[model samples]
Target: MRGDSWTESYLRSDIMRESVIYQAILEEGELSAKLTSIPRLLVLGLTREQIAQALDLEIEQVPQVIEGQN
Candidate 1:
């Protein structure tokens, strides 16, 4: 019964295995390092000051990193 339910859920969505969002969700901690990337960190609504604090970086260094990305 448990195996049947697992198979049912897996087959319910025809595109689950090919879905980027689903794959990303399954990756779990695989993206932990990317979470600290400046652009990704900014997209998650972190301010420069907050990012600097979290990364142990100088507050002034944040803008330079942002500028270089542009």
Candidate 2:
């Protein structure tokens, strides 16, 4: 009975950890998409500050993001 309880606890902990990692992965993907779209938004008449605000990024980070895309 004790071993079964330990196994269950371990499984739950592992599942929780995996869930956190999965969330991080999804956030990274969303950020990547945002970064890629910055240039397109700029070409479409959005100013750098506006793009940064819309994407929830720092205005200073905009150039770096564009550089990375290039």
Q: Model 1 TM-score?
A: 0.47
* Model 1 per-residue lDDT at 66: 86
- What lDDT would each prediction earn against the true structure? 0.74, 0.92
**Highest-scoring model, lDDT:** 2
Please estimate how well model 1 matches the true structure, expressed as its whole-model Cα lDDT: 0.74
TM-score of each: 0.47, 0.86
Expressed as tens digits, the lDDT of each residue in 1-70 for candidate 2 is 9999999999999999999999999999999898888999989999889999999988988898777777
In model 1, the worst 10-residue window by lDDT is 27-36
